[model samples]
Target: MLALTGYVDRLSAKPGGTIAFKISSTLGGEYLADLVRIRCGDPNPAGPGLKILPVDLPFGGRFRGRHQPVHLGSYGRIETPAALADVPVLTLSAVIWPTLPDGNAQAILTVGDPSGDAGIGLEIGPDGAALRLVTTGGTQTAAVGAPLTARAWYRIEATVDVAAGTARIVQTPLDPARLGLRAATTTVQVTGKPLLAGAGTMLAATPGGEGVPASRHYDGKLEAPTLVAGDLDTAGVPAGRVLAAWDLGRDIGGVRVVDIGPGGHHGVVVNLPTRGVTGARWTGREMCWRHAPKDYAAIHFHSDDLYDCGWETDFSFTVPDGMPSGLYGARLRSGEHEDIIPFYVRPTPGKTGAPVLFLASTFTYQAYANHRRGNLDEGFRARIKDWGANPNSPDDHSDYAHSTYNRHPDNSGVALSSRLRPMLTMRPGFLTFNDARGSGLRHFPADTHLLDWLEAKGIAYDILTDEDLDDEGVDLLRPYAAVLTGSHPEYHTPGTMDALETYTQEGGRLVYLGGNGFYWRIARNPDLPGVIEVRRAETGIRAWAAETGEYYHQLDGELGGLWRRNGRPPQRLAGVGFSSQGLFEGSHYRRLPAADDPAVAWIFEGVPETIIGDFGLSGGGAAGFELDRADVNLGTPPNTVVLASSEGHGPSFIPVFEDLLSHVNTLNGEPRDRLVRADMIYADLPSGGALFSVGSITFCGSLSHAGYDNPVSRILENVVRRFAAGS
Candidate 1:
């Protein structure tokens, strides 16, 4: 039994909101006070102190006064009987928590007491109740008759032992003189909540396990209750033994109970009565208890179903102030069920759980040469640039040949960044489960690929790929703490963006490891497969990065332009939009940062010039591949950060690499180029979309070349490790 406090006040007493403590009943929750107590709220908001609700077992209302008898009878049935129709039913609330069998497991139970108002049997599972009471327990049941009227104090107890697949019925009395016990029986059963000494309802019937159709009732005081072995035969018990021990007074909790009519005394059987029950009615103070536990330990979250839909369980054991740094899981069993939710624990209360993200990319790991002149790599690289994004990786499967191009784009980056992989995979090593990267491959869990390697390391991960998002849904990423993407993660679908955006804003971390990833702005028809509208300036689609003068209304759908109002780009909305470039400062480029920015040196782990330095790993301003930026259509908002910059590739001769930016369109009458080719994203500006680009192609080279003792590798390792740690 839990302690409770009650408190209430009018505006004159304690003005403002109130702080109420929770109180519940296991039998049948019908009253508020029976469950919780509370402390009133006031105007002076000094941030309150500790105050427990009053637990006056004998009292009714708030802690304002002493306990008083709670009784009300029709002073005279005038007109309305609305208030009188209220009563609690035992076995209607809390009772059990369940556990699933390692293998196949099934059980059966029997019933008694034809009145049906007695108890129920339940099947235990991890998340929800597997089974409810089976009305067909047995043919005979308990009896309520002259014996109960004659008895001064008596108690009846029925129990189900699942392990033995039996139900027992036992009768006891406060005085030894009144006692009768029945033999065990076998049949189907109904699960039940707790029973308290109070007025309860008759066994109501429904489809499967409803109370009998008899208008019978029970009245008495139950004391020292206990369940016995085997199903019992109530009719066999003698009537004198039942009436001899009538518990006329109250029980330990102080309440009354009695069976009405000739339903059953000590050895009688009455059919139960049932009807349509829309909702329950609450009277006064009442306690609620767990009748049965749940089935699943963890929920794979899905937006279609609200996350709050997750079950809320009462933690019987209070957590300690200082716990160790590790994962802790508990199985809470109310009766025979349980829910297992594991939490990351730290030594102190403020200690946090580390979030890991691994973003894979075909951009970095793919074999390609850096742009020597730092403009655009108009060579074989461009030809194969779409290789990974396109549908033409390998139509056929081969052992040595991996559909790398067709593989999941974000796998590598997300995995490495988070340092975690999937716990399960598909059969052929193609389909992936929790892994963020391999979702596109369809590699079976049993497949011997990168997925297996990850499992071997026991890395905490969920391998998911963009390909999965298309065939599947954004729901795949719901369980992750955060998601990461690799640099140059080009080519995206509107659906992909929807998933990424939802995950980030909904308290999920989204780390962009690769710039220009998911920036393709392709318009696809869910109905028509493979019919995508790419050009944003016309119709049937949109161009999220179109030029200013190139006004295109239907571009979003018909043609799908890159930059337009109807299909407006992100730069026009959120300031400081994402930007990219091939500019890298190395043996090339005139102006590299003066010794690179020292602020990022810490990120380099003491090596200041890790990304770009005297080693000349990264060349300056190679070629900005795909970058998002704030321009005319949508000048980025103020909050965006310009992490790095590059010179050249403009309208003026001041910078480097042939400055021929804006040029008049020979084909069209509108102005063609601008000073800086600011890239654009669709509706992604306000959220502070980011961009880190290199005017030099050597940036990728610098990063990839960072071998064993390479400074670049050291920098990346440090940064990635920290990222995984959620620092």
Candidate 2:
């Protein structure tokens, strides 16, 4: 439990722009707030240690603090129709594939007053499917005695007859031939009639009263939930007019749920449930949802889906007109506890302040925002205490929410990640792994190594985030001579990719400073700002795999997966693509014969060593962790030069799954061992543009080695200087 934590409304803002900060403090008192410019976040004692310079701002002072609650769950809500308030009889039916059938009671459908307790609904619990009726007189229920099997599709129907004073609930398996399953039906006399005034409909959760949070979230897939004006027959078929039928199949790209019935009781999905999924009627005849949206009609909801924390703003800071573009944090402190909410400040919109741009991997950061790796053992804790690093870990706190890299409680892959909550993993000095060789930093904190080096070398650079680039496109990169990426820029949207590719093709220099970059394709919807969706379809080194026929993103209707699978391999843009991955350990890169080419020899001008970057903060070497290599067949330019290649990785390292054809062979016919090496490559593009790629996530970690005087540092400096000069 954290004593104090907070998050910003947005990740980046232009000068003179306002950004709000929301704080959650359990400390029951005023907490100190200040602004600080973050330089280096790596907290290793042997490294530069966390370097943050305080900035004097008018908003820096003590403020009252309070605990802000985070509500997590995904559901759909439809505004109540007047016709439902006085229906003589009603029946609710839907096709369901329950993921946690034996868990607590979960609402499948409910239509009732604002207070959900007074509702006519259908639910599934540990026992089985049930029909629940609540009214001004009393409450009644009819339940199926047998338990529903997990992950099996079943049609559930519940009917209520007000004048007849009777209700029934039935559960029929979609595949009756499956073993250990059978149809169930239960009937009971109703004692009271429904009183549904000012009613609304809820799917996957029981609605809470006004100012109350929802509960009893269902974890499963629901298809074609319909509400009928009358009763359902013994065969589970509706016998009356369809009052409202929610076709989850329509609008497969947005949050709106379509209602095909005459009542026009359409609803919107909250917290982003999984859409473009295989419904009960799916026949495997079509895989893409666009081809046959009906087969992908189901929406999979989870009890832990959190889109926004909806925290109130404790304070907001409008960047003063002349504020320089850089990384800044809202530093909050309550006695012994502290948190720094980081945000980037970019130059004024359509303005340029420097020749170089540092593109912060904010999308990747959000994708991995609160990743709970479940590896925070005693040793990891000990190192945090020893180094005085950020004390909070995702494993210790799940209130904010988990990352896209994590799975839900029901074991489904978390496909969407939002930046609207406190991101513990993006904070300064936040350690990720318990590395034996170097500081265990990966994303935001790890990216600061290059920042510290740039400051040490007195280089003028402006900073912007991936989100900014995605929104602004090529125009954002057009003002800069060179652009630099952060470490492990693994997640990107099509807009960002197109922008970078266009920038590079039109004479822009791109210094790809990390590995496994331009890899995963993500989707961003303008309507849902601060959130990105990823579907790990087909192939890649992924944390979780999207189910079959669920490869498209529900937000933008784009196919989500590896960029290579989308026909735009990273090699086409940066001269290298993801090739191998290993535990956090590193090995040195040896200078290749191509290093002697006069065309690019200046890259090694100040470095005479044949073996480069053998010692550094990240895993003790430059080429380690996730690695990429140039492959002509995969779109590497013919003119690309392989300057160096890393070797001597330990047995823990292996080729990425995409490169594998079998246990002994790879798709490119390279030996498995040979495919696991990182290549440092460079290529000259048309129109005076160029690309310099250091194909390792830990490459930037070596930039600060030996007081920023090492070969890796020198090589990068040469390229940056040349690129900035338009050479």
Candidate 3:
């Protein structure tokens, strides 16, 4: 299908600030463009679905698909000061566990340029491990007798005597079953080559060729690659002759490639390969990488590992003065293809008279970008197409890139996620969990229901994001009296958490409108901007578990995992923490006895129904997908009041792993069970600040029901109005 797709350079721009867009289209004609303020992104007719109003723009342009470079692959490269001309003899040795050996020629180690006749490399191919050397005379090759077995450890060595015009290859299987087999060896001779211009560039996973862009990427684990300068000795070359030696385990917490040789030839990893992984010699004695990093020395490189797409700008647009601070996009359409590059126009920095701020969950948006679940059925696909939703997903757009939820070609979980590429899921009408009950809204688009409600009720609010908070700290939230969270703000960094926590403690009101928020602790590396790293360590609803010692983050050296494991559960910040999760089915929340208390009676100002939000979109109720609860044991403030608790969750609902010591039958949504229900909480902070938490990710999804005149809407509106008017 012909379609228009594009990406914005940044997520949020201040009034008068510029944002760049890179548009790609298959249609050969001119495309129409305009600024649309997106209110609700859900295309379901059940709620305020797909509410976007166009803002007249004076810009028009033609766009066509152009070939763009997308670098994909993980490899290690180190520049050597010595040229290939100076080093006549070289030997390379490493331990490898090939995962996809027959797929392509994986260069284990290279000493020179492959394009010219002055390089030498050891590689694994369909025929087995081989050694190839290019000298001033000619190219010489050597290989083992048989192909290497997949997932089996083997010690491989290759030596090239450039002056002698001879090359030798050797392989010894480390696996117990193959220990009896004799070491395989092959040799070849060649006769005059020419000296290459540049110094030797050492590389692993692919050759250091100048002209070949796709130089056969490696997909396996490589550990401790060593290169020696002298000829192969009968007693093995002395340690002093080692030209380069790398210990892949030294800096497991960072991206520093340690060279333990005399040359000090350190290097760096690109495209963010999986680290702290199982390597050769791992005896299962220690699972934590920190305690036994030697066992985790291997780096798993893959041919399809991608972390960034450095695309040039098609055009830049500046938000004009007086443009309302809200959700906006560069709407592009050509022929039958359409795409909207969504971005937020934040208010100009200063004390704008607005009293409320919508903190868009940009971090969470980036974390789940381009996730490919591989469960899109024919019905779901047809529904998406009929509803005018952005249909391009990670499954269909491998050219853009995969998500952290996806795996590398070697089957290792992708730990790093970058926002540099086009995020197909962040667009309007992007369904993450095609619900059986209603539209499945998530991330950036799901959060727009609150924006639509705020606009409909004429609430004056400014929009900001987690990046803004992380960059500016609490200063960004200081001007607003109340700060509101988006649906499923499940990811956060220390800076963003600190800013919001400090803001709430310093008399700024907080309205946590979602569940499973401030849950996972992620890190943004300063060296790699727009990229976030998550290590799903101990005890949470996880897709992949981080290896033992890798629970700590490589970027910030902080503990990476759930905030609950960090001892600062969401309860400490918002008076409730994640307790249970299930399918995308929702049930209504019933008024707790505490809601009738004089302290929080105003929260239910116009709501007369004892059972609130029993019917709406988002699985048909106020609490669904994931739920949180107030717990004194997990740091829920003693003064916190539970205003309402959800009821009647289906059989799929179950307590989270952290809250369970055993799998008893009663842990499932029984009455009076603390872990089975979402608790709508209210608490006062140390200062004049206060927190009102809905404790459900789908709470906002019910706000658009009955034209925003329902009890859920009334209760939230009441809280927002009172909180905005306060200190």
Candidate 4:
């Protein structure tokens, strides 16, 4: 709990812009801060290895307690004063569909503070469905006999009669006949004063006792929770007698939770729950929530749901003018615990910038933001501790939320990903997995190897993100002579695609140093920053498949899946498309006959080796994980030349799912399957610009090896220098 970790207010800022930092810690200790540029994040000594260059700017401050907002559950809240003040009798009713009935106690409707024991609450937990009323007298409880089944809808009602000093709780399956279940009811006499003190806020799915640290989160869906002061007719109650009746379905499309109660006690959702989810009364008539929101009115609340960390600004740092554009972090150290809050600085606005523009795969980083791979073993732990790279991870900080690859508590795919919370995986030296083959750098951290190489080669380059390109379009890249991409530049938006395409078409050279890029079609709402939405429909490589008619994204109404499904297969843009993928193992790229072509012979200027990238930080060699291959059928330019091709990939490597019409033995590395090879492609565009694609995620990881003296580094240097001078 004493781990020192925090996040920044903004991801990228201009040279003159100010960015804030929010720090959190268990002990109140003085922390030292320094700005440092992060180069290579891979800590393996065999690799180019970790490089940190500290800047002179340093600051210190004192902080206390963890500041991370606990948004692990979503619940509706309504405060009623008159209803709980000396009320003789009160009735609470709600429709609930519990997902984890026997897992833990979940509150359906809680009034007053459960921690204080001041009012009444309807809950289902280890003791089964129960109603508790606490007052000045003491506490009285009423409970049913058996626990409810999971994933079943139930109409539960609880009434407290203060005058009669009796409490009654009843529960019945919405479809008892179809479900083959029976209803249960219990009545217990109470001796305590009527705990009808509705002094506390009414909370659905969570205990109302939040004055102190409180929990007992419900993992389920709730709808139409109502409260009445004086119980009259249980069958047909008059609306005039209603104290607070919340229509959880009224604002299904928005963040607001509406209340039809006379008090107008409305509420707002905390950590974004799965809205437009299947309600208790859903009949499968409409699958899309947009079609019939009322049918999908229920909000699926999870115990591990987190949308943002609403932390107050602890301190801020302003980027000085002429500050080099690169990856930097706020180094925080307290006692023995230390952390680095990373952020990117782009070139000053309205500037021509450097000759080389390094395009950070921000979208890809955001997509795999908090991926919990669960592969961190003891050996890996010892390695990171020894390497001083283990700061924080999603495994320890689940309050931040999981990646899109993970599922919600209700068993639905987490389609939305937000960066407002602490992105534990995006930090420097954050490994994706403990790979047995090679260094475990991936996504954001892995991309740093290229930056390390650029610095080692003394190459001046401006850093820009996919977001910047998406917003500014070709204008962002027009000034630069060449645009280079990071490793695993997989996720892309329409604007980003258009910008890169137009940039290259308009004489701006492109160097794609990655594989399986421009593959997924993701959407980030302009109105909602720090969040991206993806639906895996007609998938390429996927953890979970989207439902049939749910192929379109709810945020932008665009087809959400592989870019290949959107008629812009990666081959058209990067000269290669996704083909084969396997474990984190790599093979070498052998020089093809086409590399000797005079048109591209300069790319191999100082490098004489026919075999390229035999040694690398990623998977031990180049061309691993997800591989791409040049294909004319998928829009690889007709003039494009395959300079070199990777070979010796083991049987573990197999073609992507879309490439196969049927399973055959020839699918792996056969001549019939062209997808098994990583083709280093180069083509001259019509606008005097050129495209050079490494066609492998591991290609850039080898650039920093041997102090940038290796063939891989030499080849890349030749490309960048030539493109900047020639283009």
Q: Each candidate: what lDDT?
A: 0.26, 0.89, 0.79, 0.77
112: Cα error in model 3, Å: 4.3
lDDT per residue for candidate 4 within 1-727, as digits (tens), equals 3266677767888877888887766656466667888887787767766777788764435544454444466665555563454566777877888888777667778777644557677888755677867866676666797688777788787877778978888787888888897778888887867655555454545453444233677787787777777653544264336877777666554567777876787777666665656677678777666676677657767767666667677788888888888888887877777677788899987774579999999888888877877766788787778767755777666767788988876676777787776778888788776766677788988898888888888888989888877877888788888999998889999999999999888888999998899999997667666777788887689978875545656556566899998999999998998888877887889998888888889999888999999887888787777788888888899999999999888888878887776666443334535667788999998888889998888887777667679888888899999888755
**On a 0 to 100 scale, what is the lDDT of residue 162 in model 2?**
81
Q: Is candidate 2 or candidate 3 better by TM-score?
A: 2
Q: What ranges in model 3 sit over 4 Å off?
A: 1-3, 26-33, 57-60, 63-65, 79-82, 112-118, 126-128, 133-142, 145-154, 172-185, 188-202, 207-212, 232-240, 246-267, 275-298, 665-674
Residue 464 in model 4: lDDT = 85
Which segments of model 1 are wrong by more than 4 Å? 1-462, 471-474, 507-509, 513-518, 528-531, 536-559, 563-604, 610-637, 647-698, 708-715
TM-score of 1: 0.30
Better candidate number, 1 or 2, judged by TM-score: 2
Error of 3 at 401 (Å): 2.2
Which one wins on lDDT?
Answer: 2
Candidate that scores best on TM-score: 2
lDDT of 1 by residue, 1-727 (tens): 1111111110000112221222222323223222112121110111121111233232223222122111110000011111111112111111111111111211111122222333232221121222233333422232211122121233343443444444433323334443352222223333332212222222211112332122111111112111122222343233221211111111101112222213221111111000000001111122111111011110011001100111122212222443222222221123321112112222232232334433333222211101011222333233323322111122221111121122111111000000010011111111111111111221111111222222223444433344345445556555555554543444445566567656554545454432333433444343322222232233212113232212211112222233332343433322323333322222312222332445444444555442232232112222232333344434443433333343334333111111223343322222333323332111223333222222222223233232224453344444444445543
Clashing residue pairs in candidate 4 are 84-198, 105-125, 134-195
Candidates 1 and 3 compared: the better one by lDDT is 3
RMSD (Cα, Å) for all candidates, in order, is 26.9, 1.7, 3.5, 3.5
The full ranking of all candidates by lDDT, starting with the best, is 2, 3, 4, 1
Give residue 95's lDDT in candidate 3 (0 to 100): 82
- lDDT of candidate 1 at residue 336, scale 0 to 100: 26
Model 2, span 1-727: residue lDDT tens:
4789988899888877899998889889899999999999999999998998998767658989898888889999889764574677778899999999998889999887323456777899988898777766666666888899889999998887788877878899989887457788888888766755547888998776555567789999999899888877766567898888899999877889889988778899888888889998789888788888889889999999988889899999999887889999999988998899999889977667688999999999999989999999998999999999999999999987799999999999999999998899999899998889899899999999999999998888999889988887889899899999988888999889999999999999999999999999999889888899999999899999999878888888878999999999999999999999999998899999999999999999989999998988899899999999999999999999999999989999989999998889799998889988899999999768999999999999998888899899999999999888878
